[model samples]
Target: MLSIPTFPETDHQIVRSLASYSDRELVSLHQLHPEQGKFFAALFCRYGAIVHSVVQHAVESQLQADYLFAIAWRQIFGELHRVKLAADPEATNWQNWLIDITGNTIAQIEVPPSAQIRYTLNTAPPPLWCYLERGLDLLPPLSRLIVVMTQSLKWKDRRISAYLQGEGQQIPPDSIPNYLIAGYQQLEAAVPQDIREIYQSGIGKQADALN
Candidate 1:
């Protein structure tokens, strides 16, 4: 009987170096040396973003997505050894296989109602949260801080201005709203079209549910 392979205890440079291997090559190495976690670690590092994207799209909120994402990876790690590359060119990709596994794992997991994200009339879904996070990175530092304080922390314009004033920046409270508008406009432009579509789709779903 084959023993289960151990996962990497921590990410290291040596494991990360295996990222250069092709998907098929990595799978072969993992199958050949199941105990060597570097190969699987390489697979995770290569495809983690896409996996998280898939999970985020399926779940209602970041917290739910994160929970399911970790569970999905655990399931993937367990079954990855049995995966084989198909002969069909389109079907042979590791990404396609991984996505299938992730979807199946998500479908099977029974999350408690309290753990699920409960959307309301005012709440934004995971897509917007993701888009806003990426968009915030592209903004000027002050604008990002202003937007976060205004929207996320629910700070009033005067409070934000006062805070900035204490920090030695003489931003008047009257300019706070303009800064928020400009920051939002920059986020709209800086976020890619595809991500924007996902954000819009999330909004549409919420609207339909609310109505």
Candidate 2:
């Protein structure tokens, strides 16, 4: 059986300490303190990229994507209390639920014709890094975290294993590569083919610099 970890006493500490929490626990904390943005912020950090990616895929311009992303999150914040889960293993999946809300929000929003034309004529598609960002968001939480630590933070597998173990996740250093392989595969698959081509064709330095 998995043991429940105790949260820190203060809101700030709790916020910083939420990296190891499950989605259900985070939602429950939000429900308990709806007045506190910190709880919801944890959820946002965990899945905000996925929400942004969904909006980006739906719209043509970054302007439109940004507009819809804000609206989607506003709707999500207001409706979060409606999310309920049973105690059983087959209970509601919070990630799927959040995705559904994002999709619905985007569907309800009609992009302005003026903005569409303005962006179409003046602005190029967002940098390739944006798609890569979205691809990382599409990964499972642990996989995403490992990839970010390894690639962005330059942490080795042993260090990542130690960090996870400290956080009550028992993944060993040897198994870390499997997670990286799976994460890389999912990331490549999630990004658009054209974007991948552009990124791989020697513009990657510029793209990485954009981040």
Candidate 3:
């Protein structure tokens, strides 16, 4: 029988303390102390969901998604020491780099025929959550960013506009809603008909329940 290793109590405390560190700081810590797994754990806890979302959108089956998710982490772990943060504290280069790595991993995978056929026939949706994620991926980058920030991150329009401006793109607050509307329109058109109907039905049910 094989034995699994467990983290020490002190490592747990280290992970907890590292949660206050920013993404760049966490990456720096991991690079500086490659033996300390807690720093990497903290970084994964912070950004793993985003990575999972990307993998989910790229692959059809949960099994495939899970396999690719682990690969993504391995790739990130192998490459973290090479990452350089920008001088600007608010730069999103670290997050973008992780996303790029996941994209590259996805590109290397060959989708099985059965999954492709099922998707083509619109007989099955990948998963409830994946419908929206796939749709989000189909949108133009700026529109996708706005929608993800608004929907997934629960950021307000003003905040999104401010963040974009800080990143050097000056999107007005009043225009955010229009971008969101356009994003959903693009999403609806990009997804399969059955998936779109299912998503719309869920939204309808939620609205009905709220009334």
Q: Against the true structure, whose lDDT is highest?
A: 2
> Per-residue CA lDDT of candidate 1, range 1-211, in tens?
2112223322456555665677888887878875355566567656766777777666665556655665677677667778888655455678877999989977898644534334331243233333345456778999778877875566899999999999998989999898878877776665555435433443223322111
Residue 16 miss distance in model 3 (angstroms): 1.9
- The models' CA-based lDDT, in order, is 0.62, 0.63, 0.61
Q: Better model by TM-score, 1 or 3?
A: 3
Give the TM-scores of the predictions, in the order they appear. Answer: 0.46, 0.46, 0.46
Which portions of model 1 show Cα errors greater than 4 Å?
1-11, 86-91, 113-211
Candidate 2 versus truth, CA RMSD in Å, comes to 18.9
lDDT of 2 by residue, 1-211 (tens): 2111122222344345787877887788778864344556567656766777787777765656655665676678768877886545467588788999999987888877434332320111232344456566778999788877876666899999999999999999999999887877777676655444433433222222222
Question: Model 3: how far is 179 from its true place, Å?
Answer: 62
Off by over 4 Å in 2: 1-14, 113-211
What lDDT would candidate 2 get against the real structure? 0.63
Model 3 C-alpha lDDT per residue in residues 147-211, reported as the tens digit of each score: 67875566899999999999998889999999878876776565555334333443211211110
RMSD of each candidate relative to the true structure: 14.2, 18.9, 19.8
- Number of backbone collisions per candidate, in order? 0, 0, 0
